[model samples]
Target: MPIDQLVTLLENESIREALMIVYERSDGGTEELEWRDVRDALSSEQWGTLIEQEVLVSAGSGFAIAEPGRVERLLGGDDPSEDAGTDGIESPSWTTADKAAGAFALLLFAGYWNTGIRDIVASVESAIFGPVAGLVPFHLVIVFLAVVTGFYSTVLQSRLLDREKLEQYKQRMTDLQERTAAAKERGDEEALERLQEERMAAAGDQLGMFKLQFRPMVWIMLLTIPVFLWLRWKVRGGHLGTGETGLVVPIAGAVTWQQSLVGPMQTWLVWYFCCSMAARQLIQKVFGLRTGTSS
Candidate 1:
């Protein structure tokens, strides 16, 4: 359904004032207006709303009124009696699928400590990897698993995350910080107090950011845990015959897969992580995959 443009423009006092400012500065919609022209008169929220609502459209160097005739008509009419509530930061909610995946991931995590779960997962996975294990050394199998997991993990994160929304959250926080610092420098207690209130409200955005970061991790874990359990079973269940268990690693020289190299971390786990990190980095560079927020 189309937005009730008149209601949207007239409902919020800040948006109405900002629209008037833009109209005057743009010479009654004949010209375009840039942020610098009205930055002092309008807040970031107001400016964001104008762009989001499609009231201001991209016009070369800046923005112009999307529908000058409709804006003129709305401005000339009586104000809306019901004032709109203040807009809060909209945090993304997890879908039912995401929750389900997270639950399964947690259950899979228990396989690391529980021998019953570990054995079951390993037995199931052996049917798939047993043929390959027969052809290559166990260390090569670890390398192959690491590379496969790394590729999918990187792709999943790039596809699942909302870079634009994360950027918006960052921009809002940066704007607030800059304004707060300026208010402090000028010793404006009133502006400082107001910015503090805005900061408190924005605290929820941090949790939202965390949620966005962790959503992909749940899926990654769900896929990775089974592989890990299978590897653990292979190492501990005496599946490795004679020389297959030993691997030569950097600094540590020759070490058995079961040998503890770093604190409680065994040789296989350490080797797996090193291979995974290198493969993930190489895959990202080769494919131009982005996992971090854009600048």
Candidate 2:
């Protein structure tokens, strides 16, 4: 329907109020509203207009939303949980015991793989530069590790997240917000109220999407924490003594007054942070990872 026609229909406070009531009642099946409930608010003429517009249909003793799904969508899409009530949380009902067993096996394999990688990583470290200047070889290894971790995490996150669907929901919520503001500006109290209700429902959906996005983090962290601990042991050699640079930068090898970027920070923590930040962007691009704030 055209905006003008919709506005004309809704211009009547009674009709607007009736629609809101019907929308609120419109759930699983077709919503049925009796004349007694809305008769005091809406006149026979207004009710007839609504019926003629096909927004409402006679069903035995009451009227129901004609196309409940479409109207609900226009009112702001229904919550996905309305049907299944999962609220974006993963349902274990369909996950068979076999699938659960497979996941446990995968987790065990990851633990074993991480333990075996330490020696291999050390070999890679030794071969790369064959004992370069103070911490330079170690720095190279740190960069390489950071890049690998970045790529792995980004790809895993993308695989776990329904980013396209999340983005679409966000866009729709934003559009609804804009429409709500327009209604408020025009002093359409009924429309504003209905839009606000819709926006709140959309917010719930967005929260659910965000929860799904982080669902993979539990698995990722399980593997990553052990690997990082090993890296920490290698880099710090189980301890950090003063005046020992973890990774020395060749160009500005020493932390001088001129090189304030690092600001006298010479620990593995700082090195890892710098490398991770630098490599994350490149790795995200290579893996086609999405970077954006969830609404």
Candidate 3:
């Protein structure tokens, strides 16, 4: 039975009194309740109504509350259906550090299009990475950056994301969907309507889920954008020598770092992307880190 109907049933004075009597006599619904046991307090009509509504189903010899825990909760004045999906899950709030990181990440993102910001970031980053670049070819430098970014990205996601809470949120929605389907199959319009209302109320969970997934991205962008700027500076500022400017990649064979492999994506960016993906997968496998909720 839907909680709404159970609530409605409790509104009747006679039904409420009868339920109280039955609950008390049955030891909080631990034992079966026969009509004869509460005959003095409950009227025939109330007993018949309880049976008709299926609130009490036949046990081995007598009737018992169909769902004792639900009945107990309702009687205790708690509404289980209120905030169905967000019952135990707290809303994710961004801390001051998180907000600061996001703000800084946004500022860094401007370097991608603004030449002055790009040069400043590249100049600052080159002081740190330039020595490494001087030793290895530019392609190897790109691979090294990819591995570093991939490792940190995975670690940030694992630490920042609340995997258990995410799983709970998903499981609650899945359970609601299954209940909705069952109600539809049974042609229970009242139950279906209640489930639909619950589903609508749970819609705010989508935003909560989004916040959970995006919390780590700000940190990632803050760390990654500077390395990208440095790579761009190296290519455009004639930092790469004759042999370091090109690479023999898998599909494209030999291609210059600045050559366009995809629609606006340069060869270097493509290679970095491929390397980042492979490195991320390997890191996750080796460390048993999970960035997403399990099925």
Model 2 whole-model lDDT (C-alpha atoms): 0.56
**For candidate 3, lDDT tens digit of each residue in 147-247?**
99999999998889888877867866776776666455445566567677877878878888888878988889889989888888888778787778588
lDDT of 1 by residue, 1-295 (tens): 0226556566788788889888888887767788888999999889888988767867667787764544654676733221111133457889999999999999989998988998889988999899988898888999999999999999999989888777767866775676566455545565567667767867777888889889999999999999999998889888886778578878889999899998999998998999999999999999999998963
On lDDT, the stronger of 1 and 2 is 1
TM-score for all models, in order of appearance: 0.70, 0.49, 0.73
Among all candidates shown, the one with the greatest TM-score = 3
List the RMSD of every prediction in angstroms. 10.1, 11.6, 7.6
For lDDT, the strongest prediction is 3
Model 2 per-residue lDDT tens digits across residues 181-244: 5444445555566666655645566566655555555456644554555555454443323434
- Which regions in candidate 2 have their CA more than 4 angstroms from the true location? 1-136, 235-244, 249-266, 286-295
lDDT of each: 0.79, 0.56, 0.81
Per-prediction backbone clash count: 0, 0, 0
- The C-alpha local distance difference test score for the whole of candidate 1 amounts to 0.79
